[model samples]
Target: MSGRQTSFLAQALQQGAGALRSRQFDLAERIAGDILKSNRTDRNAVLILAHALVGQDRAGEAIAPLERIARRSDDGEVETLLGALLCKSGRAADGIAQLRRTIARRPPYLPSFQELAGQLSKAGQLGEAISVIESGLALVPESVDLKVDLGRLLHESNEFAKALEVLTIARDAAPGRPDVLIELGRVLILSGDYTAAADAFRHVLAQRPDDGSVRAYLATCLLEQGERDAGEAALRAVMRGGPHLLGRAAFVMAASSHGRFFFDMSEATKFLGGKST
Candidate 1:
């Protein structure tokens, strides 16, 4: 390529990456398209375009470009990304084979296994995902991220008991980490142990006093246990402190249970300084 053309191509790639970071997938794809139009053989441009397509939920269109890069590169990251895109596009079997090949060649790259686990889970290959996660745990036994992911997957698969076990271990290992605590609390809630879930949420809140989600979860547990007044108080506190809290579902349940008139007219207005309808 000529010097000016090369410079333009590089600038296009940079702009595409910037757009991707900003979550402007359509713009990123357009820039990537321009780069590919000039040089279809540009592997980096193809990979960027494929990623943009995937981000835009156009995974089917991503397949060809990603496949081309995967075929030409031995990079495990590239293979894993391509496999993930393929699986997301509903080519589960092909994605699994590609991921397995990549893992077999590079076992130390834990993210590949993590991505494969997610794909397998989404494909309803729960057993396979669990097995892959277990193998990854054996390889990197101290990875808190992997353990948390496994616990979440187990919970989603309705293996609640196993989820609790994995999350408990992770919580014990990483005490005071809000992510671990929140996940453990969520699993406990899924298992219908509302009191335990509430306690876990409380523990997390003790560390992060401003966490509206934790407070809302605790309020939910209280409401579920028929502590209507306390639950309303907690929910009001959350709304007062974190007005933009995203746990409105929990608040709504608490509000409804306490009688909408008292919740909306009395507590909400007092705490939040606005009428609640």
Candidate 2:
């Protein structure tokens, strides 16, 4: 390629990346397609096209371009993305192998490992995902994100106590992080520690007063503790502040009441569409 052609390709690739970041997948793909039409082996064009395809949920079409790049480059990130795309496209075994190879060749890149762990978990390879994440944690023990991810995987596997332990550590490390607090609260609730869960939700509410989800969660904790009136008050407070909170609060109240009739006849009539006509 001439200097001008190379420069044009580079500019197109840069524009494509920007489009991808802004979620303009169609524009990104168009730019990538133009570049690829001229230089079929352009690595940047291939990578960008593959990413755009993945973003557009066309992972099947992304495979050929990704495989081309994977064959030509030793980039662990590329390998990881290809693995994830493969997994998303139902090629689980191939995806797992790609991720494993990338992890083996490269040092512990947290993002890659996290992606791999998620894909592995989805592929019913929970043991492998846990083992990989645990290994990564050994290398970066203080990483709150990694801890949270491992905790989430553990929680998904119904290891609620272990998830709680991990999330608690993450919350202590990043005391004011809303995400960590939320996850900690979730695990606490799952572990049947309603009181602590409520406390965690309250901590989050202190940091984010406008968070309707936290308010709803706190109300649930209250209801779970047999504080029906208090829970109802909290839910009412949430509903008053934001109408969107009403749906969530109603859901919590419904679940809490075990779908039983807790309302007066008039209120029940309203919910039952005016006595079922």
List model 2 lDDT by residue over 181-212, tens digit each.
Answer: 88888888877788999998999999888787
Worst 10 residues of 2 by lDDT: 268-277
lDDT of 1 by residue, 142-213 (tens): 988889889988988888899999999999899877888898998887777878888899889888887777
Error of 2 at 11 (Å): 4.3
Q: Evaluated with TM-score, which candidate comes out highest? A: 2
lDDT of 2 at 55: 85
Cα RMSDs of all predictions?
Answer: 4.8, 4.2
